[model samples]
Target: MIATAREVKDRVIAALNDHDTEVVMQYFARDAVYVGPVGPAEGREQIAWYFEHLLQAFPDLQITPWCKVPACDPAVSAVSEYVMTGTHLGPLLLPGGSMLEATGQRIAVRGAGLCTIENGLIVSDRDYYDQLELFSQLGLCLPEAVA
Candidate 1:
């Protein structure tokens, strides 16, 4: 049976909720591509590795979807925008051979994701989020002045 977009969307959210690397990996196609704020990554192994590292670096990370749209086919694809909130309570490797100290600071970021499912697995995934928000939370920048 073809996978409905709703199923795909639900599974994606469920995976995040589980915060289990194996569970999240189960939803991806073997050759799926993932694009996030950091950059593009391909294949299940790479995506799993990235997620695992992220989970280690931010143990309290959670993502919540704000808007969801199922494709016309109700299968194969969908787009979802989300808000991610987490605390920095572990080492975050940065440039210059330095790791940022965990400030226990909370961060909320806006992000958008596009996913394509084929053969009941997500064959492609793409996401975009605010880098500035991360920088600001890390004490690298002053909060932007409101208009």
Candidate 2:
């Protein structure tokens, strides 16, 4: 039997918490698109790369879903609010082609996600989070503008 949207979302979350990239990729369609803080990753390969990078950066990363909106009859979508906690033990890639070295800082960031499921597989997943908040937790600061 085909899994419902909630089932798929729960399974995906479990896989992510397990830090099993391969297992997480299973719930995504071949052409799935995942848009996260960095940007949009198209296809399973790109999405897998994104997860791998995240896991490498935070080997002990944990995701806790606090709230979930019920899926309707069609069960094509799922929305959830979650918190991700981990330690910065590995290099983190920045948007401007720069890399942030490991700071050994523990971070807890709240975020939300919307998953679009098709045939029990995720076709598209968009994650929303505060980049500034993440950076602040990592002890990073933006330079003040000069007049």
TM-score of every model versus the real structure? 0.85, 0.96
Query: TM-score: which candidate is best?
Result: 2
Error of 2 at 127 (Å): 0.7
**Candidate 1 positional error at 87, Å:** 0.6
Count the clashes in each prediction.
Answer: 0, 0
Which 10 residues in a row give candidate 2 its minimum summed lDDT?
Answer: 69-78
Give Cα distance to truth, residue 18, candidate 1, Å. 1.9
Write down the TM-score for model 2: 0.96
Stretches of candidate 1 above 4 Å error?
93-99, 142-147
Q: What is the C-alpha lDDT of each candidate?
A: 0.80, 0.91
